[model samples]
Target: MAIAQSLTTTASLHYTPFIRELFDTLLTDSWCEVSSNRAIEFVEGEADVAVEKLVPYETRSEQGIFFTADDITMKIVNSLAAEVAVEKSFFDPSCGAGNLLLGIAKSYPIKKNLNRTIEYWSKKFGGCDLHDNFVIAAKLRLIALAAIRHGLPSISEGQLASFVRKFDKFYTGDYLEADVGGDFDCVVANPPFGHVVASRSNEWSSGRTQLAAIFVDKIISSGKKGQKLVAVLPDVLRSGSRYERWREKLAKETSCGAVELHGRFSKSVDVDVFILNLNNKPSVVGQIIEWVPPVTDTEGSVRLGDLFLVRVGPVVPHRLEEGDEDFPFLCAKNAPAFGVTFPEERIKFGGTKFLPPFVVVRRTSNPCDKNRLITTLVKGIEPVAVENHLVVMKPFKGGVNSCLKLIKALKDPKVTSRLNNVIRCRHLTTKSISSMVLQGV
Candidate 1:
């Protein structure tokens, strides 16, 4: 508690002595069940601390507890609340400081016409976290939000107690360890990402499991029939060798859709993220949605179906040596940048044959970046077999030119600027090549 108090105090620069003293009192209090009067006192004290510390920081700065970009959160909230008929009860399993929840709540329409809907939805919204500090922060955020919506900073003792009781919605246990009791109408979470090591008796070790894959599985398992979920997943889940079976299992178990976001949310780890949406209803075979930059004034967003092919890189056994000419490979380590360039010495001396002309995208990496696409327009090659750690995509038969167009189009400053460290490639498809040739005409 001293550590918490010190951190909070240092983080808050504009607290009055009264507010500071109140916080110091609450920080030392060990009551598991705080009285309503104490809760109100605590909230008022914390609000002063938060207000001082809540000054906006640059989008890329790490000052905020939530790492995701604000724009990303806005887009997510907009998408989730787009349809009014959908029972929109928001739930975040890893509700860190309630940022996502707060963002959603703040975005809800406050006008008289929409007040009823907002109130109805707020009552149904729920969230939970494994950290006690986060629960406290989330409750403070809710109190602050209530103050903003209404004109008072004070809640009655009973109301304050009720708020703390609901704040119990935020738990203090491992998400995977708990039963999660009832399924949510909609679940949104950003679970931890990385490799998951499970013993023989653990559920995820039937084969290799990416942390994101396991978390995705957990989200789906936590949902009841008709429940939908949106969770942030590492790019590795989309393109990792360890996720092949997991992907198949997920696809088979539920209908899934995703939106890919480049760059790390907050941490230095440059992981690619996707907003995955799943439901227990019959599979809806969702079309891939790519967020291309705006086009002409009249045409802003474009949604093309089946325009790109997605395939995984070849998997060579670990026992195989590098000199194998029969199956030349491209491991994650060898993935090239935007332009198809690799160390020639490694190519020649490493004894790996050059893959044929095809676009090779890295399947997995420690820090997922945007330049995952690799274009190989080096002429006179046909479908090349990609090695483990890379996924190759070629445009359909007539897409050679389109593929080329995509390559060139991707070279635009706008596209390339975003592509840095996120995408890479070494091959091209006939359709891609064809597309490149006919782009502006």
Candidate 2:
């Protein structure tokens, strides 16, 4: 059910082996119904595998997991494609059954006849996917859409045969290595997300990298001036400290626009996603990027980073030994919310240790929960070894009194709402916590 559930509205037609078989029969029957030579030839030629293989690689591999939901796909397409003129073009490097590309095509008005329309639109719209079955599905859906849009119950067999040839740009291939020519007006994609093993030589990130992040860099590098890239990327690329350098590099390449948070990709997939809009070229000189979208209600508020020395707890329980039996050890389990906690155990660690009069927030959180930040005050007399799962917020200028005030501010409902917008992922990032804006502090 987990694999089947990953299928979005776009991929709903062919999820299981039985469904794929039906889809295959339907496409073959449609070609026969049209009595078209080229369309039939195209379908038969690309039949490398059986219908069972078309159930999407997402079910089998981490590399090809998570497709964009229908609402999200249409939103990106309509927002970006609406501004594009009829003469302008759109392309998706990793189209994945043409979810985004189909939305783009649907946004445009249908021209003269179905054949002429497909001919003209095919040149304006282009995409490629590594899966051959996905490419076939995309072409089939486009042809079906053309027929429906043209106001016919169905175009006669021969009348729509030319469509199969018109979609020459849609093919089965890897976009990362392919030569993506032409200056497209907009390039939209929901690239795959997961840790990639191979080393990367890109300027944004090197060594082990995320596949989605690498796809973004490749797409940007392939883009021409005046081009726009609208991508649904993992939230970590925006808020994780590991990508801070990548963010810095991205700022120099493209002008960052909107950062819309869409919590948790799917019920099955644990990753959170955000829609990032960027123009390929740097419109402004020396642009300093604001990774998280700024909240508008901060009139008299200041960033938590300015008021506190925010850091993740330095203790890794398995790695450290009991050096001082008398020292206290504090972890999330024993750190009660809104209550004072004293470390009871000790660890032999040479890393940063926190003293009392500091606030501790649980690093793991859920946006769907009633409270996003679970806070506790540590007011012991001795230094404590805090577990890595808790984020320690030590006031820079304010001592014990400041810690109490900070706790009060964090308890506000507005703080929870704001933090939800800042980082939707389950694990709260240190950078995101630091970026938290506190009111009346």
Best by TM-score: 2
Model 1, 1-441: lDDT tens per residue?
Answer: 343353345333232333334434433323333433554544333443343354333421232223334655666666677532354666777675566666666655443322333344446566666555455566555654554455333444444444545544556566677766235667767666545565476444554455556656777766776677767666555543444556665666666454555445534434556566666444464333332222332233222114545455445555444443333335555555555533232221232333344455444323333433345532234223345555555555444565565566544454434333222222322222222211231
Error of model 2, residue 126, in angstroms: 1.6
Query: How does each model score on lDDT?
Result: 0.49, 0.71
> For model 1, how many clashes?
45
Q: CA RMSD for every model?
A: 10.0, 6.8
In candidate 1 the C-alpha lDDT for residue 262 amounts to 46
Model 2 per-residue lDDT tens digits across residues 297-318: 5479888898999889978877
Per-residue lDDT value at 239 in model 1: 43
lDDT: worst 10-residue window of model 1: 432-441
